[model samples]
Target: MRLAWRGPTMLVTDVRGELGRGVTSTGLWFRETRYLRTMRLLVNGRAPHLCALGGQDARTLDLVYVHPELEQFGGGGSGLARSEESLASDGLPHRSIDVRVSHAVQLDGLESRYVVANRSRRVARLVIDVALDCDWADIGDTIGDREAPVRIWARAVCDGSSLELRSTHPQLRYVTHVEAPGASAHQSGVRWTLELAPRDEVVLPLRVRAIDFEDALTGEGIAAREDALARWRASHVVVDTTGHGVEPLVIAAALEDLASLPLLEGRPREWLAPQAGLPIYPALFGRDALTTGWQASCVDGGAMLDAALARLGRLQCTRDDPRIDAQPGRIPQQVRRGPRARLGDGAFAVSYADVASPLMYVISLAQLFALRGDEALIRPHLDTARRILDWAHEQAQGGFLHYHTRSSDGPEHQGWKDSGGAMVHADGSSARSPIAACEIQGYWFAAQELLALVLWMLGRRGDARALWDSARDLKRRFHRAFWMEDESFYGLGIDREGRLLRSVTSNVGHCIASGIVAQPVIERVVERMFAPDLWSGWGFRTLSSAHPAYEPLSYHCGSVWSVESTTIALGLRRFGLDRRALQLADATLALASLYPGFRVPECVGGYAKDEMPHPGAYPRADLIQAWNVSAIPGLLHAMMGFFNVAPLDLLTIDPILPTCLDRVRVKGLRVGRGVIDLDVWRDRDGRSHFDVTRREGTLHVVRQPPPESISVGIAGRVRALVEGLLPS
Candidate 1:
């Protein structure tokens, strides 16, 4: 068993309450550098017997252990003196002992508390030792299974009761400080000898700090950290569910995980940026951040989107650099701040392998603009947005958006499904470079339309018309090139030679969700999406099970990604496939409940529902992924059919709740200049009812009539209304 905790960084420990595995993964890491590679505890030259392990919060772990029964009885005492003899005769050991270990992790360091107790009729003596070492390896090197350079070195220095281990390399300098109050420092670590009488106990406290290059330890205690965590949790919208089995728990866990992932300090700027996930990608990723922020728009009232847009704007690529795949106007794929991150010839801190990140950035900004009519927040970034849009236009010169990794060390594939073997033909052979993924085109179409809307709001009619025309042309070409007429489904992508990579995948769902697929073909695509080959009961599989390349446990070929399923569900609702959308939403919620803490993972094994009890776990998936956790809020919004164009002073509600969720209430839902508290419930006759219990501000509520009455140009009408609100 393994236990883990995360704050601004992350720590992982094995069952023995030690980090001495020496494997590529186990250790303390900050800013993509492994700080402490090995740490072990020994009692009387032997490891303690494990009893139980649990965590009270995301940042604390508790472990209970005990010595061997024979060792506790004083090792073959012949005479069995007095009380010891009586205890042995009564079938009890001469001494009963217990060891409890508690680990508390903070933004800057870790504190561990050890308690030893003797609960028998006799006294006991114990020897305790803690062993430690550091390798100072870069996380990328560790994950890639490459060896660290020999220039890296570690040195330990002792000063009285405290010890410090420092690792240095050309790119990074790391230090770990250890302090044990009453213990003596040695070459191995610190040591302690203790004597405890009957029912007596002793407590030992140890502190380990991962010091920043220019900052000193503030010596803040656990109380301060807990207070900070409480404030952070209080900043988000609160949610509660009534008469639901797992809904309340799911909401609570989602909010908690979101609060835990924010970078507390030491970022490029003072603003908070969410890390991708824990124990692995605890760094800023452009795609993950934008997706998470968009999904969390309703909960945070677009605050996440606002911050993400600003941060990405600051980190946007300004020049062409083939070494790191950096191109002007491109958003970074991933950003790491550490010494080893500076080793590359080009700027390695920001890599531009993700072709979809800039499009995601544009979509997120549009989402924020729709939620709040604050042109003031977006006005400053319009120039950056136009630059990204221009880059997209240049890349799509051949009638489709394509990507080929320019950096030798960059990812082979650039879309969300970026694994090496993700893009393959029906024969299981990999697709060639410069591939045009189905979803990238969808994103490009959406981004162009969204930017056109933004331009219209700003009274730039010519620019708006040009963008809309480009979007329309791309949509037409996408329909003609990517649609598989014989199969009644869309192909995964087009290879470099202009041949369709005929593999059925979940990317088609994104096309529908993005409104890139033609209206006539949407129903057919949705029908095929919900068929047995694509819908795995848990969620939508990245690739169809019927495909020759399908492997349930493969990273990208065959996996159920919550984020992808959420996107498809949103798209289904957009196109009026209410029943199918509700079905997918319920399946995603059910999958969340199957995970350990009700926290969704980055991806799960794509197994058929009837064939397995629950979704199989992907071996290396991030357990608390930001986008995956955001799926809860995304699902809620999809089921409720809530959409807002705040600038136009309009709100639309089209309830399509599943039967399982009889009643749903969303309180403190912020939009535009006010908050909305809404309740929707089902009557005995199965009809849905809506009540706006509370509405603040001048928002016009429009309850969508039925499927047939919904006008074909409703989206266009909303955009026009928003444009009309702007001053001429």
Candidate 2:
């Protein structure tokens, strides 16, 4: 009964083996804490504070500083370190608590009750605890001088009908006294009763504040240990019995227990191999070494994938706006709602960036759908996605796709890296619009090819071929017009003027990866991308090192980005440069570890490790960035050589596991036909082999090697039946 629904980019699981359902891992626990806003209590609390005293030196603690404004990731800190100034102003408002007593306790059977209420819709369990630092000693001063003295004191009074306060400690001596409400006021202990105005709404508030007490100084008032004791006394601890049923307290306790244990030995995710300089661990269950501390076995990888697919699917938008009262169709949206504004015509309309995003999502969804070959999923989104391609085609002009009329914002850099500073011309100046950048073109080609594949899989041969033909035409046009002869690379952009903006950059390589470039182009792009001048130990800079405008610290000018590097690695593999692709994958993983914390960063400084010695921070990097994490699993698939024969209930695994990875296992891998257990290992001879055991549904494995040159070893008698088949 375990069910998972995939959305356009998110996966929700009701299964008992993964993140939210039934699995738990220390690594996964960190996921919840990585994002500041994810925890409701952290953001909206009263008198909020970030506390950390255990482990690490105070200097290390001082490194954590907060910024004045909220960043995209919700963290607002300056530097990777902590600071007291930031800590003091760190959190939200607080609740106050006051104690009411009817009598000074001389009796043992006294009862006290507390009333509480929630003002916010978000649920939060209350926690109360009190502590007494009786022996307040400064180790620094004590080490060089005499011991510091301390004393304590207080007084209380209670009325029969009014609230009373009392000094809980006999050692407390009263320094100051305030008059009580009744004539029977002055006593070490007195009784009182209090009245509340709102009988149903009044609630108990927890308060932690400094209090004044008597100093036990002698008549001499000498400057000695006794003198210090006279001025300062014991600090009391107030324990609350309210902190029950909170998961954070429970989980924090568990983590504390684990932290006490000796460190466990494990493998890094990169042990399996690399994809575009990134590690290549299996999707669901990672390598034991790499996954040992991570939550790898929550749900079956198959079920998780299915869930992610479903969540991402729900977010998938299809169908652009028609002229007026148009029929709804299944094609992906040509223009989706973005930031709206009132037009001269007196109506709000969507912007072009918003419109183009739908196109990107459709392409992403279609690719994932084809890979999984889920007919039910495809049937729901297929036609609309195809229509998106058709619509986008109508917007094409001058051998390149232009921003549609829906793109009222025009083409002010409509790609994912849509920052105003992103686009540039050949001479390193910014480019004018009515232009299409190279990556968007790649995405268009990818979308068309994906739609064609879907159509072909669904028995629409003619339609599929026609779309593929269009893609081919675009591909040919792209190659001819965008190619830069002297630079031996493709231009980054081309405008309506037929002017070329050539830049030897990451975007040019993305074109190669999209399979839009003819073979000759891919070879040249790959050669330049991995060159010593452009390649840092961590990753390829956005702009190659040799470029005049290259600045290693620049965001788009020279920084190494995960999404771009991932596409480059994919491109290398697409061009049959497996070894080189693997090198990049491994390198990216190493670069990923360069992040002070092993968690992913959106992009890091493009400086070589030697130049910076540590990963440089991209200012305002989204800490728990989605695409960065996604690239990890995607890179693994690329290295593993896992792909689907859409429409057919078939899967092909041609594992090229690096020798570093002894063995990798994947359980519950869902294919079009059914679920299967896939095991891959690298033999001592440096060759890789795989044994895919079907667990559910029927699968006819094709034994023949695919036209591609990746290696795969098939097991079971079912292997030959598939190998003898055609079209593999």
Candidate 3:
């Protein structure tokens, strides 16, 4: 019963196709304010009998209701225009009528289309009453955690076929328009009457648009959004799975979700830079976009990813502003466009205090350049990347990077697991301010090492070596500062008092992905990763089950995040634990089968496999998260050992196919201007084989990693040709 549809900007109405019906998280919201709040459909003075709800597209919402006692109306009973079997409705078997409410959620507004069909042999008459209202409330208000500002109730003026709503308070003025054909607007709603011939249908449309709002801000200016679903299917990456049971469906679902995230209805089906997710986080998040883009780059996100990086470059902080924790050369955590953000009211208007964002941005640039090999794509952001490095170096104290926030609006914990008390010690003690998380150090190490490789390729040898030296030094100190010898794993982080927050969390797995985990400790880390307390069987839990503060449904304390699982799985693959990595993917995809649309949510319950009938839903999970969708491509790419370092005009594939996926053909995978179609399969003897079904460019396909081990000079690449399995 808790169904919803999402689009650019968006409508969050419930299954009743009405706002404020069963869930308070239902309304037409954009940025920080709810533009339209009240809407309900009535048949003959009372709500119709609800039957079913469905939609195939991400942006479309459909609800079918039955009007069991639809009676003939005369001139005195004028209203809107007008379903079922004997057991389907309360009416007789031959006297059933169906009313379907179809909604097209758009950037500037939403359009509700009512299609009333007479399924019975007799003619049908129905009176439809649509109540409309608007109340301005921030997202915090709907979240119901006492953080939201007061709601703004607008006055409505009704005219024939049109209703105008306007609200003005101390903070802002908001307005919206509602129009429908042949609708007689009353004090706050509209009424319609229709007579349909037997087996006939009538489509009555109602449109709502925000006054003076620009659709171009979030998506294309067009409101109809007719071709969105088609483009999601036929555009960019087309993955065909022959025998991979449900995972292929999950893969296709992920690709569709990624293509539709931006909600653009343009032809040629171009994918533009997108927001973080739907319902909430409808804006560019630095860590989310950078990380997601890094994974999506290997498949079909090259065009939009560079654009996102450029935008992040532009949004990079140029000077110190402690009020928002904006440091010179630091990228923001999230960028917002709502009026509250512009007017300095929203807590996350432009948060920049996150510790991992700058590092992820730099790493994304390195990974993207490796795939695209276009120097110009990253040239514009080099200075920003350098300054970010400088900021990281400046923040480094005693060879460890720490994050602290003094602003009231700034986040308490700066790592990805930033929920309150997420950085707790094993004894359930909170890690105090200026905390240095293990994952941050891993990202820091990767940022420096990868950027150095990029610089070395760009003719900045001396600069690259300095960074490499710094990275090598950090790796040595990292283990000393955070490793817990007894637990055979890295500690969670170090607090201001220099006490390691010794919690056996999943943060160490990220260190594996970054190539920072020591070889001596790799097996131990892997052992701890699969330890009963850490592996939930569905995926890796953020905090081990044995942790004192572990909560199955807690946002970051113990929930199984799809993105987190993908990262950990990739790390396992990098460490030559292919089976373990594929196991993680299989478990994740199996969990994906339980979710709606074959897509993973932001996070699920951290319960073990046998703990519940299904992984309990996290109370605040976003079903269409950007990073969650991007995980599909990352998981697939890892499965094939496909690494594209296009700077050398090379793509190395060392495949070890898992049994679950029998045959996978990837088309439209771009490396620079050329596209590739690759086929990967596993033989009955357990040997992996890949055939380049089609290639359309001057790309040299190899079965080895990029030649990044040029220890001496560019001319020495031949002598230093062999690259290890370790991630560059």
User: lDDT per prediction?
Assistant: 0.76, 0.42, 0.75
Model 2 agreement with the true structure over 133-211: per-residue lDDT tens digits: 1121111111112432321222334344222233344433222222223213323322222232322223222111111
Evaluate residue 351 in candidate 3 and report its C-alpha lDDT on the 0 to 100 scale. Answer: 79
Candidate 3 segments whose C-alpha is farther than 4 A from its true place: 1-7, 69-95, 120-124, 144-149, 212-220, 223-235, 263-271, 705-728
Full ranking by lDDT:
1, 3, 2
RMSD in order of candidates: 5.2, 21.3, 6.1
Candidate 1 clash figure, as a count: 2
Residue-wise lDDT of candidate 3 within 611-717, one digit each (tens)?
A: 78688778867757888888888888787777777887777776666666788888877776667788877788876777777888877665542232111345433
lDDT per residue, candidate 1, 1-728, as tens digits?
25355545577776566775545566776666666777777776667777778888778878887663443333367333344343332243433668898888767677889898887666777787788777766665655334555335778888767888886554456788889887887755787788788789999888888876644335553345446546545656656554356855776788677666665443233145577786667788898888888887777776666667778888899999888888898998988765556564344467889889999888878888888888898887788888888888787747888999988888899986788999999998999879999999999999989889888987899999999998999999998998899888888999899889999898888888787998887888888988888899988888889989999988888898989888988888887777788789778878888888897777898999899998767886776788888878877777777787788887777776665567777777877886778787867776666777787787776566223222336785564345333211
User: Least accurate stretch of 10 residues (summed lDDT) in model 1?
Assistant: 719-728
Residue 359's lDDT in candidate 3: 90
Q: Candidate 2 — worst ten consecutive residues by lDDT sum? A: 28-37
> What TM-scores do the predictions have?
0.89, 0.55, 0.89
User: Which is the leading candidate under lDDT?
Assistant: 1
Error of 1 at 3 (Å): 4.9
Which segments of candidate 2 are over 4 A away from where they belong? 1-356, 404-411, 701-728
| Per-model tally of clashing residue pairs | 2, 84, 9
Better of 2 and 3 by lDDT: 3
